[model samples]
Target: MKIHDIPGFPNPLRVRVVLAAKGLLDKVDFVPVDLPGAEHKRPPFLAINPTGTVPVLELDDGTYISECTAITEYLDNLDGNPILTGKTALEKAMVHMMQKRAESELIDAIGIYFHHATPGLGEALQPYKHPEWEGRTYWGEMHREKALAGMHYFDSVLRKQPYIAGDFFSMADATVLGGLLFAFYAQIPVPSALTALLEWKERVDQLPAVIQASA
Candidate 1:
């Protein structure tokens, strides 16, 4: 199989972490797409994925898979261990639900906040180069506040459970981990009430899978 992705980008990073956790990194060839140059927007690349998003997985049979969460689910089910996603129907439902919650409430909100507000890496991320989004104080401020509020909500959720879905570490944890890192990279300060969130991040960071994928 072949995987195309960008390093450090929150969504793509989620797929990489899943590959590492599933021990499929060595088995798959990881191709790094040039995001800054808008390579993904070009024809040859668009032929593979119309969305032109990072973390596109191509199976040996010529099937392509996009979307970070879907890729993680595909990888998890490839083997019998079934740890990253879930084994039973109920577990799968809960895992998918929690993953959706994190993506909707935290990841997507934070992305809107960052892209429309602070140009962190600036030109290195080409989409933010448009002047239309620059200096729009009102919307930027609103999205930033929404992103911060989402983090606060996640902090409360983490305080009650060992993992986002409840107990076992599932795909939801991976999604949340990448989102928090994005928040950190974007210079959003994690609130003090999120002690559990911080602790969970530390634990996930220590995993061999995380270190390898991040490297």
Candidate 2:
């Protein structure tokens, strides 16, 4: 398998962490996509993925897979352990539920906020800002409020449970982690009152898979 993405960014980092968790990092070759250069947005890459996104997984069988959720589903089911997703029917339901919430309420909202505020998280991330999106301010402030609400929601969820979905660390947890990373880059501060969320982040940061991926 080949992972076409630039390392260190939020969405790409999500899939890379999943690979590390599944012990599949060593098996997959990483092809860097020039996100700043608009390589992924052009016809050459668009032919591979119409969505024109990063962290696309190209299989050995000559098939391309996009989206973190779908890529994660493929990886989790591959080894049959499926610990990062879910095993039982109810577990899958719970994981998916939280996963969607994590994406919509947190990651996706932050992406909109940051992209509109400036291209590529602006000065937060070097070499990601495109010339077109520079100095362009849209409805980013509105999404900033939305992202803050998302942080509060997740904090409340963490206060009630050991993990985002339930007892086990599922894909939802990874999505939240990625969102938080993006929030940090976007300079969206997580309030000091959200101690539970901070504690959860600290705990997950120590996990072997997360540590490996971050490294």
TM-scores for every candidate against the unseen true structure: 0.90, 0.92
* Alpha-carbon runs more than 4 Å astray in model 2: 119-138
| Minimal lDDT window, size 10, model 1 | 125-134
What's model 2's overall lDDT?
0.88
Provide the lDDT at 103 for model 1.
88
Per-residue alpha-carbon lDDT of candidate 2 for residues 184-204, written as tens digits (9 for 90 to 100): 989898999999999999999
lDDT of 1 by residue, 1-215 (tens): 99998788888778888888888889998789987677887899999999877889999999999988888878998877789788888988989998998888777777766766776456656453354654655565676677677777777887888788877888888888888877887778778777877888888888888888899
Best by lDDT: 2
Against the reference, the lDDT scores of all candidates come to 0.81, 0.88
Clashing pairs in 2: none
